[model samples]
Target: MEEVSLGTGNWDRLTGPVREMFVAHARTWLDEQSDPSWALLDLDRLSACTMPVLLSRGSTSPSWFSMVLERLAAALPRAQRKLFEGLGPIPHVTHPQQYTAVLTEFTRPAEAGEPAPGR
Candidate 1:
């Protein structure tokens, strides 16, 4: 799964719907967060693309995808925050603790994860 986010500049408004998903990963990512401005830069770095499918049995669930989903869930408002919980841990790539670790990192982890403000 690919992820995207827009910032304080109406990226969400600019988004359009493609097939299967919205055209604006940036908008979707940002709106999911409490502070859209912080995630603004992610918009530039992220884009729609064909990602390689990892074939490891451990890759079945896909750690990379889980990472994106977790962050998306945490970015959303509390009422809508259940998105993160729904992704479920990646079969072999992520541990239960990783769910929190990944989500918190997406918002603002001390180290090892993308912090808010897109740094």
Candidate 2:
């Protein structure tokens, strides 16, 4: 298996020890996985959320994941979608700064008594 995240970004900036640590963690996480109950997902439960939601996906992610994201975004009452072009499955790991900036912008509090943006 690859020792690093796919696509370009600051993943190259990781030190040898840090990279090894991530690899170890990835191994542990992978070793602990069981078959997911994808069919049991409750799409209707998504409608219960009152907070603003931001749904994102990398352009290169698998079709099934993207389809799920599209459905979840559509089900939510207040949700915004963002597509990260030229990234891989884990955009946050590959593009931390950009991800953090977008997350901060989306989650920032609204001005006094004013409606939040992107709702």
Candidate 3:
């Protein structure tokens, strides 16, 4: 985990305590990993939800993550996606104010007939 973190530029950006915490949590998750039951996820049932969904992703995340995000957006009825330019995998940790601003703006009620941001 340490080597991967350093290789991915996360070690340089993260504080010592934060890195340690992340490593500990990652180890725990790895230890807890098991075969996930794919049958539990009913995509047809999920697609029935009509509420607006906001899907945000950092620009520097793994390519596969972006593909998953695309798939999730397509599966949902009213999903809006926003790619945070120049941000790393965890944008809220790296750019808290910008992340908060985007979230706040997106959650605000839109004016009549006006499309929401990122729509």
Candidate 4:
């Protein structure tokens, strides 16, 4: 199987255990790509979703991933986009505190009976 690591940013920053886990799961990750259903993006169905959507990505992620996010953000009615700077594809695993902060900030307004930012 091909070597698998985070798509961008500092892979070295990932803990050894985390890196090992990723390495061990590389085959499964690659196998997922072979499923045709994984490639589908039904924008019409997505546009019909009325719930709040938080679309996040690492600033250092591959450009194609950014493009996909941009497309989804445009299509989704209530999408709020966030960029986590200096991180890679799996920011939540690499920087849990930062990820939690972003998620909390996104949900705070809703929890307070206020409209989320994009709404």
- Please, what are the lDDT tens digits per residue for candidate 3 over residues 45-86? 768878788888777676645766777787889888888876
The candidate 4 region of ten consecutive residues with least summed lDDT is 1-10
lDDT per residue as tens, model 1, 1-119: 32222112222333244322545364664566556454343522233322211211122333544465455444433212223332322322224454455445445634655344334
Q: Please give the lDDT score for candidate 4.
A: 0.75
Candidate 4: tens digits of C-alpha lDDT, residues 1-119? 11233554456667889778877987887787677776568889899988788888876676656877887998899898889877666678778899899988887766658886656
The digit string of per-residue lDDT tens for model 2 on 1-119 reads 23233444445755578678777798665654444755345778988877778888777665666777877887788888888887765667667798899898786767776566545
- In order of listing, the candidates' clash counts read 5, 0, 0, 0
Q: What RMSD does each model have against the real structure?
A: 16.6, 4.1, 4.2, 3.8
Q: Cα lDDT of model 1 overall? A: 0.36
lDDT, residue 77, candidate 2:
84
Clashing pairs in 4: none
Computed on alpha carbons, the lDDT of every model, listed in order, comes to 0.36, 0.70, 0.68, 0.75
Query: TM-score ranking from best to worst?
Result: 4, 3, 2, 1
**TM-score for candidate 2, residues paired by index:** 0.65
Provide the lowest-lDDT 10-residue window in model 1.
49-58
